[model samples]
Target: MEKIFTLFLFLPIFALAQKESIWDLEELYKTPKYEETDLVNKKGVKSIFYESIDYKGKPTKVYAYYNIPTTERPENGYPAIVLVHGGGGTAFEDWVKIWNKRGYVAISMDLEGHLPSKNHQDRKNFEGSGPSRHGVFHDNNEALQDQWYYQAVAQVILAHSFLRGLPEVDTNNIGITGVSWGGMLTSSIAGIDDRFKFAIPIYGCGFLNGTDGLMGQHFKNGNQAYRDNLLTNFEAEAFLPKATMPILFINGSNDAHFPIPAMMSSAKAPKSKTYLYVEDGLGHGHPPAWDVEESYRFANAIIHNLPLMDIQKTTWDHSKMDFSAVVKGVRPRKVTAYYTFDKGKWQKRRWNSTPGNIKGTKVNAPIPEEATAAYLIIRDVKGMSLTTEVIFDTSDKQTMK
Candidate 1:
C-alpha cells in the first residue's frame, strides 16, 4: 500500500478554555479519600482505597496499588507516576514495582472499579463492577451524566491531586502512562489534567470515530447523534489540542486497537513537544507489547529535565529521505531505516531494514521504491535501541481503524 506523510506544526496556539470543562476541580479536590489497605504492604508498594464520585453523584471507592521509591531520594522529592491499565486489567502491582525500581512513586488504579485479582491468570475472570458498557466508547443511555468516562476522568484528575498531596512525591514532576484503553484515557487525561508534566500513551489515542476499520467503526455504525456524543465527550482528538504538557506517543505500526491514521491524527492535535515510537511487529497487550526501557528513559529524562533523544527534522526528496536526531550525551553504534511496502495491511507486512550512514547527527538512506512507510532506528552503544514513528508514508488515505 502507498504511505503518505504530512508535517503539521505542533504550536501551543489552542487554549484550554476552547473545550468546556466536564470536571469540577474544586469539588473533586475538596477532600482526600486515600484510605490505606493492609493487603500486601511491601516496603515499596502500598494498597489503598480512595473515595470518588460515581455517575449518580454518590460516593464510591476505587482501589489502587501505590509504589514509592526506596532508592536515594531526589533533593526535591521523588518524581511520581500514575499508571492506568487497559480494558480487562486491574491495579497491576507489578507495574508499580517496575516504576519503583526505576526510582518513581507509581500508582496503578483500576478504572473498572474492581480490585486486582490474586494472580494474573485470575484477572480475566474478575468482572469489574463499574459501568462496564457505558460512557467509554459509546453510551446512548445517559450521555455524560452516567458515562463511565466522566467518572473515570474525574477519578484520574483526583489521582493527580492525591499524588500532589503526598509528602513523598515531587508534585511538579509527576507523569501518567497507560496501555490500550488506558492509553486512550491517558490521552484524555493529558489534555484534561494540565498538572501532568508529561504523558506517554502506549497504543492509545483519540479520533476513534474518524477511523475507517479500527475502533472508529463502533461510532460509524451508530446513529449520527451517538457518534457526535462520543466524539465530543471522550475522543482524544478533542482534548489533545488543548494539552499544554509534552507527550510521547508509543505504539506498534500494526496495532489493531490504535491504527496509524488515527494515531497520526491524535499526534497532530497536541501543541506541545510530542515524540513518537512506532515499532514494527509491535501489537496489543502490556509490558513487552510496549518498550519498558524507552518508556522509563522518557520518564526519567522528563522528570530530571534532560534533553530528549528524538528525530528533530526530516527532508524527503522524492525517493530519498534525510533525517537528523539529537541523542544527547550518547552516540549510536549504528543507524538503520526500516520500511514496509504493503499497500494497506500493516498488521501482516514484514518490515525491511536498510543500514544508514550517520554523518555527525544526520542519517541518510535511499527510500525503497516499494516502501510506503518508514522510520529511523538508532542503536546506541549503551545497548539501547531507539526507534522513531513513521516519518514518511506515501498515502494519507483513510483506511480501517
Candidate 2:
C-alpha cells in the first residue's frame, strides 16, 4: 500500500520531467550567446553563429545571415523579421537583403548547421553543428533532445531570442516567415512561441498523415511509436492551437508536398486570425515562395497596425451553381474563382478560373457542373491576392457549401 501511494506521488513529477524534456521554454527564451563572423561579405549583411540546444550532450551552433535597412531607424526601433529556409536551403544573403530593402531588420538562419553556399549538397558543416535533417521522422527513435525537429525548432526560437535582444529591433514587431520545410517549422513555432507578432508559412501545414504527399506517406507507414511521438511533440497541429498571433498560410493548389486539405486543416487549427493564399499553378521553391506580395503585405499590415483583407464567410447555391463570399477590409480590384474537375491527385489537376461579379462587399461566381473543387481569389489594387478555403463536391451532384 505504501509503495502504491509513493508511485502515485511521483507520477506528476515524471509527467513534468517529460514535458520539460520536449523543450525547456524558459531556457530557449533567454537571449542566446552569439558570435558574429565575416564569412559572408555582402554589402549590408553579416553572418553569425549563435548557441543552440545541445545535441547528444555536445554544444551546437546555428549559422545565420542578418542585416538592417539602411534607412534611419524608427524611434521605437525597426520592425524585424526572421526568415526560415526550406529543404536544401541555407541562410541566404539575398533573402536578408530583400527584407532590408523593405525597411526592416531581418535574420535568415541555417537550421541544418551548414555554412551558406551556392549548392546545398556542397555546403560544409561548421564545427559544433547539430544533427542534420535526414527525413521528417527518420530520427524519431533518438533521444528527444537530439532529434532534428527539436533541434530545428530550438534554433529558430533561439534566433528569435537573439534578434529580440538587438538594440535596433522592435522587439514587439518581430515576425517570422518560412518556406517549404521551413514553413512546417514556422507552423509549429507559431504555436510554441507566442511572442511573434505574426507568422507566414508558405507551402507548409499540419495534418501530414492525412495528405497524399511523400511526408504523409512516411507518417502513414511509420511505426506507431514514431507516429505518436511526432504527432504529440513535433507536428504543427499540436502547437497551432496555442498560437495567439495571426497566421497567413501560403501555398499552391497543386503543391506536390503540402496539399490543399492539409493546408486548410492547419489554417483552421489556429485560434487566432488565419488567412489563406493558395494560388493555382503557383510553383514551390524558395525564390518563388518569397516572391508572393501578399506575404509582404500581410507582415507590413500587422506590424504597422493596418487592416488586412478579410473574407467573412463563403456561401454556395446548389440550384444556380453560384459561389459567393462576403469580403471586407481592403477593397479588391478583382475577384475570381478557380475550379478543378480532375479528381484523383491534387498535383495533377488542371485549374480553370472565372471572373466573379462583385457587388458591393460581396463577390459571386458560377462554378461549372463538372467542377469537383473550387476556391475564390481576391486581388487587391497592388496585384496582391488572398484566397478563401476550397469547397469540394464529393459526388456527381453539386454539393458545394
Most lDDT-accurate candidate = 2
Candidate 2 segments exceeding 4 Å error: 1-21, 381-383, 396-401
With a 3 Å backbone cut-off (N, CA, C), the pairs that clash in candidate 2 are none
TM-score of 2: 0.92
Instruction: List TM-scores for all candidates, in order.
Output: 0.87, 0.92
Q: For all candidates, what are the clash counts?
A: 11, 0
| CA lDDT for candidate 2 | 0.82
What tens digits encode model 1's per-residue C-alpha lDDT throughout 165-262? Answer: 88889988999998988888999888878889999998888766645436655865748777666667677777898888888888776777677666
Off by over 4 Å in 1: 1-18, 39-44, 118-130, 133-136, 289-291, 320-333, 379-401
Tens-digit lDDT track for model 2 on 124-234?
A: 887899888987778988988888989999999999999899999999999999999999999989988889999999998776765676566777674888888887888
